[model samples]
Target: MMYHLLPSPYESQEINHLTLAYFVISSLDFLNSLHLLTHKEAVSDWVLSFHLHPTTIPDPNNGQFYGFHGSRTSMFPPDQTGALLHNNSHLASTYSALAILKIVGYDLSNIDSELMLSSMRNLQQSDGSFIPIHTGGEKDLRFVYCAAAICFMLNNWSGMDKEKAKDYILHCQSYDGGFGLVPGAESQDLHVTFIEMMYHLLPSPYESQEINHLTLAYFVISSLDFLNSLHLLTHKEAVSDWVLSFHLHPTTIPDPNNGQFYGFHGSRTSMFPPDQTGALLHNNSHLASTYSALAILKIVGYDLSNIDSELMLSSMRNLQQSDGSFIPIHTGGEKDLRFVYCAAAICFMLNNWSGMDKEKAKDYILHCQSYDGGFGLVPGAESQGGATYCAIASLRLMGFIEDNLLSTCASSSLIDVPLLLDWIVQRQGTDGGIQGRPNKSSDTCYAFWIGAVLKILGGYDFVDSKALHGFLLACQYKYGGFSKFPGEFPDLYHTYYAFTASSMLEESGFNSLCPELGITQVAAKGL
Candidate 1:
């Protein structure tokens, strides 16, 4: 049902066939059924055919772009003048090809490594970022991460100037502690001229959203943790103070809900006028903000004792429904597996089972399991890699494992381990990258989403580490971050996911990730 129809919206993505191949074949490998694939030798040949050898191009300048095309369609007939046509190699496609070959058990020895490396080197820009294939495209962290992975895989660093690349990556860091897509651009300099130009059009400079702050905090903090440079945070006390302010307190508010939950930022409205009755309304908290708030606090080594655990726990309980699912707050909004996971993480961090009814929560989670043997956002919805991870991690955090699920429900296991393992492993497609759902293009973020589930399931041994390495390398941009899929531009979201996923595989040169918390093992120590 998933294979035949590429939706009309996806017609343009036809060039991504190579990426699709990597996803399917690599997924098969993860399932320990690569041998099930027929015509393996022929597939390998097809992938190799995309490789653009420098020798084939008459112009030396064109040779610099030699690698692999996204698909044969990228090929064009020779021009009337017989000069080299402009269809050049793509870093992403080359990566996909290499990874697929390796998954099919072919060493890279047969390819012209020297020529590919030469082309790859030429993609490096003066600013240490990379453009996927040519000089005209936007350069950013995604391509840089891809370049690093490619060089690492081929056992050559000659392709990129690592020091300069490192500098460009650092430059992308904004004043707010997050790396933006462009260096220095994410930061708002309230320059007098610029301020005068749009003073009336802008919101107050002092007003920034808390969720945005927390996200930036996570990126900066996690990046430092990954680099083992967390010790550089000399103003740890100030950082901790900033995080603690998000906490709600009873004494500070006039209502019952006060101090029972932690809102994302300052209250949306002032405290109820002392006379307000039943279930105080304004300034509700969110599960995501709570998780981020807690994680950041832990990362900064704040004393957990300072938190009103009892009230927080009480608030957490209030968010639960009879079906064992969780809502982010009392305010109406969509509920799903994500909030459940956050609530579970909160209780786990607090070391209190009283926060939630584990049995009911477990039941709700079981209800979310889809027919495909993976979990979805809600019951009977499509299975997604991110939702699946949230479901499984919530279970694990609640102390339910394969054995526990079987024993507690004896009549029926809450989770079907074997079936789920099969489903998750099959997420990897022929591209050597994993997708969130069936028939979707392989995305880089699923590396963590599905990869973490595999970690919890004890299925890492069944995975092809080398194949994943190759895909991640291929997804790298000439810049410093990773993209969501091959041939796509990189973004911070995918870049972080790539780092965490590589960490899960225990890839050399990456810090170990705490699967439950989604942070480096070192970062978890602050808790």
Candidate 2:
């Protein structure tokens, strides 16, 4: 009843889609079941008559490239060249697509430097924040986070105007000691502040007591989530105690009075915060909450020896479906790479896999792998890096691919890692940057998902580090943010992940990305 109202199957425009593919495959990987691949052509060919290898246009004489899709249509169009150009080098898809290829065992040797740089340039905002693309959307913490991450990944700061961008984020802070989506906005969310303060506040050498008091005591802790990544904190102990308070209502350990922690409280915890009750508990469990909560726990250093691990895992257990993917919560909403990643993250954190059925999960992911050889957010869906990362990580976590997903089949041994690696390589555009999907352009954020997955798959030796890192640096803006694709504006999501990816790649840009607040190495880089 609930899922029917959520976003339906993948729309051609919905590059980040949800379905049975990633979730089921993720579950299978969780349970150590690679045999599921024998069941289907889940990986044959897609988008028909179209070929691989990204195409690009130039921005000017200084070596700027603009990446565009020959088409965005899911179905074949009679006019092959008429397809809308995918100038939007979004942070989410950039990484998601890369991760997908990594899952399929593709090394990223085909990224295009100029195309990637152009998307990075396009997304940068003069203010320290980034936009997903020049296409336009409201600016705030989400985009800024992505932009910061993207820049960090590519070793590029050309996409942003650091001084102005930093000023813009500072302006968004409210009287309540938190940040808002936009300046002077009534909806003050701690999530926004947590992300913003880490990037924009806390002067270098990071000794700002005001920033610590403001962030440490005030950030929302319901469901135990504070931010997407850690390493930004000035005082680790303060954050630990702050996170510990959220469990007050539960029975000592992270258990259920209802089992899962309450979803909202202390401000950003609620969907409607400014006028809400004593922090109205959303009788819901969300991937955002789950991921944030567990991440907070990891940063805070809570020993699970005292916790009720089974009860919490059981809470997520209820969301699993027969098809093998997980719902957002008991609300039974959309299933995509986002939630799938959250679920996998939670299990990874707890070091447990009981809640999900693994073999079936792997089958779902295998089905989602597009004919182009990249992994998608779901079955029969376009491959995305974020979803691909969720799929690969979950599989790796569950110890799938011991013999590899395609090796066991008697009829077809064609689904080996090298083939998928080749597909991932091809997604790279003219600038040596990896794009999200076939016919899609490159962005700065995928450096982590795609890069990390390649490393995890034991094929790190194949990457062309010189071209990839140079492309990352080329995409950076003057401001502290990174853009979606080159020639586009910057956004937070990309920036954060870009930082993460860059760190993982061991690029020289790591220190400059986040010298303030002391997050030298972001999780994305670690992954």
Candidate 3:
């Protein structure tokens, strides 16, 4: 069952659909699947068209960029009811655009930094939070990550208010110390942890000095790894304990009698009742479980050596769809490219390729590459940043770094490193931080995906240390948080990503933070 290019979240649902596009493009870029793209020029031009210039700051309380259109059409200017439908510019799209640009090898030579800064200045909320786009949509860690990514990429952060943003990041911290998407939100999750880690890792730790995003981040990440059914994380002394206590659910229960695992307990469980088991899954396969599990393991510092690497790969490979891509749920009914990315990442993280059928997945991605030279989520789908990231990252993890990938990547020689450095380099934004897409505004979390991707790619050299450092500083919200676009609210997902980006930048400069993710000299876990 193919996903429709949706319109609105409810009726005219568009964000969900378009966001998929972003993920698709970003994944493609990550997989090093640009060869499948039809016309890189047209793709680049299309992505940039979303760049809304002359943005007016909506509020001065926090430095933020105003929202722009999400797709080709505009959703601003409320109807008679004074209800805003949606904006075309989404932080997700912004990040996606930049990611796409890099994938296509556009140094963003045509991007206007100042113009984006102006737009960024307008999207601020007094509490140091930001709306998704220009009055675009809900503000959350996802957007915050996008904002921070933009600033990191641009090599400049002169867009958002710092104090308030920092405070916001601080405010969202739970008693457990892990951060959530919104303040007072329930238990932490992987996406949120990723974002919070990005922000908490920010420099000069403003009001957020005591917040320790990494400490809590470990918890959230640990949990995510547990849920993915990845044994390494489930065995972690602390992580294993946490899951044993808080996450078990009937649906997610390892066995009907065991009830050992929760159904993505950390991820916004509010949406579904705590008791609910299986989610409304698209695929018969549960790739989401695979991804969250892998991400969590990465966060929890799971030693791959202790567990059966084959289990994770086997789980993923067992769920492969006829298309050679993975399916998130187990039905194997609806197969999207996301599973491919998740499966690819799982294989990459495990340092094993047994689970992934690269040839088929690559064929699907290539088939989807439009005449514009950008790959889409599924064959014939529009190109997007998130998806591009998935694709490129998958390829890097697959050890398929080619000249085209190297040119798009930074520090070409680093490709030989365990992590696919070529794909990571392309994730960088013209600014310094990495955005998911081009022409769209920049965001925070891309730093994690793009930055981490770069680290894995071995192109940490391509990043400009001072410039990226400067960008991270600017994206810091006054409330002690980080935003994807400048001048926006901070969220957990983006915060973690931003920090990861900074860590890499600093590491590239020879200043090691937390052992640059997958680099352990020669340890199997490091691989």
Candidate 4:
């Protein structure tokens, strides 16, 4: 079976033919059945044929990865001068080829170890991720593992930047104490599909209720705006009116000292009926919902100045705690970076600052930065992608931080720029997708959540945009929208962020986004 061609079912996997051969030969060796194989020299020679060699002295920076082709098809024909086309050499295939040679007891030293190791350096990205091919491929843990295996077999450390790779592996550890295939991704699990299906089918009741309908509306409206297709939205006025209806307006100018918050309800279910005197029986108004409502209104080209800005801003102050952290709702909720961001975005959009004390908010945001450089949802919490975005974006919106701080006096910057950059750049997994926290699966939402942070800090170029594009394409739904993870169903939130991330990459047909506002630059300018 090892000597024969793979069956028809494996034709689609022909690109991985060398890997399949490695599996067979390694298994036979493990089973103590290696003696049954005849013509070992022939097998060794066949595996060696896949090795890519440089025509001249090896140039690691020549933009070609010299390794092993996975199969004959991947090994393109030589040029007119008879020089081999080395473009298709892959790290994984090279590892497989090397293992096969060792299994046959071939003299490993006969191979051009120096050339192989030097050329392999071409695949390592600045963030310590390794692309499988020189021509570009997913940079993830799998490729990193393959590179390590290859180096171990050849006894060569010169092939890669070991310190960089080590840092990348360390970053792959998730908060739940397991290593993901890539940084900021969830730990690998065999039951991921089943668990994801269950999550979609049977969401927690509390979580289901916590799904702010107004936020969903914001995602939809903002996505449309980003796509430059807001014109596709029929009855624009009606949409604006519906969003406005969610607002909790006071009969008169609201007192900033009032404990009650006059904002927007997350959904009608959370909106209490008014009493006989037209007073709200229960002020279920939430800051998050209010932000989403205002964002949607902005997207729909509504004049925010026409709304009750004084009442909204004054009542909004009631939700801000003395610590400068804000609860999502007047009824009280968790005080964290998320709500602080919401408050900041709300104030920025309204062109008002009376809602919260900026100095206190800035201090609160500064305290949330962890020793590792990433920001957490709250002070002293684990650094997270979303929290980092919330912290940075809030500061940007409030004018406490400048755009491209890394380029503009990073040393004097309030946050630890270097550590933050180190933490964030590692979030780009081997698959090119960004994860929100360490060891979590790369989700579509983080593309925007984390990508925006990079953009703000002038570190967006550090991420592998090509790899990210591939990941986004994989997660794209056949009909429309994008999924949280590839091969899953799509949702409004992920789809919206996917659009914004694409826009950040400067993908054509997408309107430029105002990262701080989470809206199109055109819509933000309307404010």
Candidate 5:
């Protein structure tokens, strides 16, 4: 769904236009209505526009990282001599752009496979994990998967050092039979290690304090999928059983919405009312954990045949506020776009719309939009890429973009499309990475947050693919991982988003991503 005018919340995501495109185009494909997409050729051209060709340097070795930029904001002024500035290519964007093109049936005969492959080759580390950008980030199983997918898609294995990558994946296997983000790189802090060990020894996360079980569950499942190691999980049933235990029944719930819900733990005997609620304000069910719970179930191939869907839906409905914002739990805490996005995602996953009042939710999302055409956590709050993403995604899930595509409604009737687009384009700095807000340094996560929004806006082609690639490279590290910014330590969160950002920017060598669901389209095929 699209509005002719860009909504304010989408302003911060200008860099991720390609990702937005993936979500739009892929969704159309899923509905078997791809033929309804307007300007198919133009859309394909826009995706290709992100491609970054190497400059004409004689024997260009260092500049071999040609790929695509994340957005046009990365464009820089040329030197007085008028030579084009170099923009390093990114593996993730390369793959994503190509996937978008392929989905639209764009002829790939003229694609520069050699340049793309050469760039990818330069991203591989000794241990087999591929860095997302030339500058580097985290080297983990995620990038390894991206590299492999890229090579496989290009029908070229030369892009990656496959054997080393395999070894890296193997090394990541932990004593508990789970994989961490990095190989031989589990937390080394003695205190952290001891705590983790204690955590594992405990029968459930509920018994422990300060643990976000949702993050743990998603990481475990996602890591396995990235490595294609789900088959290695011999105790699937046991894992599933453990996850299921987090479910809270109406009898156990303290709120008016007496529905079966999922939580981070079952230790809380009663739901906290809005004032005394610990998480946000009132402690109750957690939206993040609910998503993780459902996702884990799907990943485990459970088909959700045994879950109480009605009760779950009712629980979700209870989290909704009159303002259309959602609280993570019944106890009432922070009301922001994050939970709104979560609620929308949960409803989407459930194939139900009753969890929220769409009109009221839409109005509330519009309220959070800021003057800069970006979305903030609340009215008058500063615009942020993450918040912008949540707002736009919620709108998309509510059919804003689709409605624009299908109807002749005036831009004024929806969101401010023109200004929103302009604001998004302005987020890219000369460094080629996207900034979350004005005057802030670019970070890795915005690549997905802003990029996906831009893709949705159908203005991705306007970005400077090369410059964005170069920026991501600058953030990449020598050890095979990406960081939030240049020269920072790589973490799983930034690294994963970097991978997706790179994918959306240009073709690095992977299948198309399902932006809404945050998984590979191929992986989602069965669903």
Candidate 6:
């Protein structure tokens, strides 16, 4: 069955051909059925074809890993001199390729061990974590394991810094003793099982269901703006009024330092009626909802100056913790890169920076940058897709980072641009969709989250836009909208991001987006 399936068309799994080949060949070898395979030399040559050889002598500092391609599609054509134009060599594929070669009774010594080993060192980061490829990938234990396996197979320790890798592995151990894929992440047992079992179980991309209504409204409004179809809303005033009704108002001019946030409620359910004296019973204003509310208002061409800007900005200060992180609400909530982003967007939309301390917030955002050049939700956590977006977008909105940062002052920039570029470009898998983190399947939304970061950093040109468009087309529902993954139910959240990502790619019938604001340039200008 496995042998028959090998040659059959696996369009969706084409990028994983080498991995699939390993499973079949290793399994057959274990069953003592290796003799059943004919054309042993042909199979060896087929596997060898994926090897990425350096045109010149290996320079570990060249930042290109001379390993093996995962599949033919990932391998680019060679130049006139028979040198590869681009190296898409991946460590996992190299390990699988070597395993298949070994099982086929091929002489491992014949391979250029020195070139492969020396170039492999380029993938290891300063913290001792190994990205899967030299182009940039997630730094985690999976790549470390693959590197170790490759070194073991080659009997060469020159490829990796073992002491650094050891330190990284040690950091991945959680308080409960089990190791995570990366440091400060959850233990692998349940986490890995769920990831393995469910490709459709879309994790809540952002936390808090309290703001679901507002988030949906933002998606609808912003998506309409992106399509240049905001004029389709016949009752634009009614929509604006309804969104503004969620705003919390103070009976009197309150102290700016009163430790109370006056913002917008997420939904009508969170709005409470006033008592007999007209004193409000509850104030459930949230930062995320406020951001969404303002975004909706801006898209509808509402005059933001008419609103109580001073009250909103002054009271918002209460949500900013001393460390410069922001809680979404005045009461309490998880303070992370997400809320900081919301706060920054809100301030940007309002044209007011008095709400939060820019210097303090900038300092806080800097702390969230993980060693791999991607930002996590909080300090010391594993880098994530959404958090990385928040950090970069927030910085762009706050004016701490320049637009097209890579082109401007990357050398003197506060953040590490080169590593960030490497990490982001690697998110685009061979399938064309972008994953949020390394070693994960691509999703529809990350095309915006991570894609926006690339646009801001001037690294957007590095992405394979055609492949990404193909992936997005696959996720499109026959009825309408897009699913988180292909062949699943479509949701507003994913659909909105898909539209924005498509716009960034210069898709027709869509307006260009202002990446930092997550809205159209026209809408942002109206603010």
Per-residue alpha-carbon lDDT of candidate 2 for residues 110-215, written as tens digits (9 for 90 to 100): 4453355555555655445555545666666676665565455545666456675676666566445677665434322333453455444544443533323223
Question: What tens-digit string does per-residue lDDT give for candidate 1 at 269-356?
Answer: 3234222443444655677767777777777778776787776787677777889988886665678899899899888776777778
What is the Cα root-mean-square deviation between model 2 and the actual structure?
27.7
Tens-place lDDT per residue, model 6, 1-527, is 87667555777888988999999999999999999789889999999988887665656677888899999899887688866667888989999999999999999999989888888898988767788877786778999999999999999999999998887786566545677787535422222233222222334753455446776778877776776666667788998898989988877556767777889999877887767776555778899899899999999999999899888998898999999999988779899999999999999999999888999998998999889998999999888889999999999899888889876755535788777777888899999999999999999999999999989888788888768877886786655567899889767778789888988876544688999989998889994
* lDDT, candidates in the order shown: 0.71, 0.50, 0.52, 0.82, 0.66, 0.83
lDDT winner between candidates 4 and 6 = 6
lDDT (Cα) of model 3 = 0.52
Model 6 ranges off by over 4 Å: 1-211, 274-281
Query: Which 10-residue span in candidate 4 carries the lowest summed lDDT?
Result: 187-196
Q: Ten residues in a row with the worst lDDT in model 2?
A: 43-52
**TM-score, one value per model:** 0.56, 0.49, 0.43, 0.61, 0.55, 0.60
Alpha-carbon runs more than 4 Å astray in model 2: 1-232, 244-281, 304-307, 402-416, 487-489, 508-527
Better structure of 2 and 4 per TM-score: 4
- The lDDT ranking, best first, is 6, 4, 1, 5, 3, 2
lDDT of 5 by residue, 244-343 (tens): 7766543443443543244444223433433343222333568877777767766666656477666667667777888888887766678888988888
Give residue 339's lDDT in candidate 1 (0 to 100): 86
Instruction: Please say which candidate is ahead in TM-score: 1 or 6.
Output: 6
lDDT of 4 by residue, 369-399 (tens): 9998899999999999999999999999998
Residue 10, model 2: lDDT of: 38
Put down candidate 3 lDDT per residue, 1-527, tens digits, no spaces. 02223344444644443455566666666778757677878777776766654334333333334333466555355457543344355666677677667767777656777667666756656657767756446665555667777777776687677676776666566545677786534422333344334423543543353223323444334323222312333345675344322222334423322211122233323224432446423222245544454454455555644445554455455566667766654443457666677677666666778776888877665555444444467878765555655655566556555423434544434223323333334555667665565555556666655555445434555766545655665676654446777777765445545545544553211113222222222222443
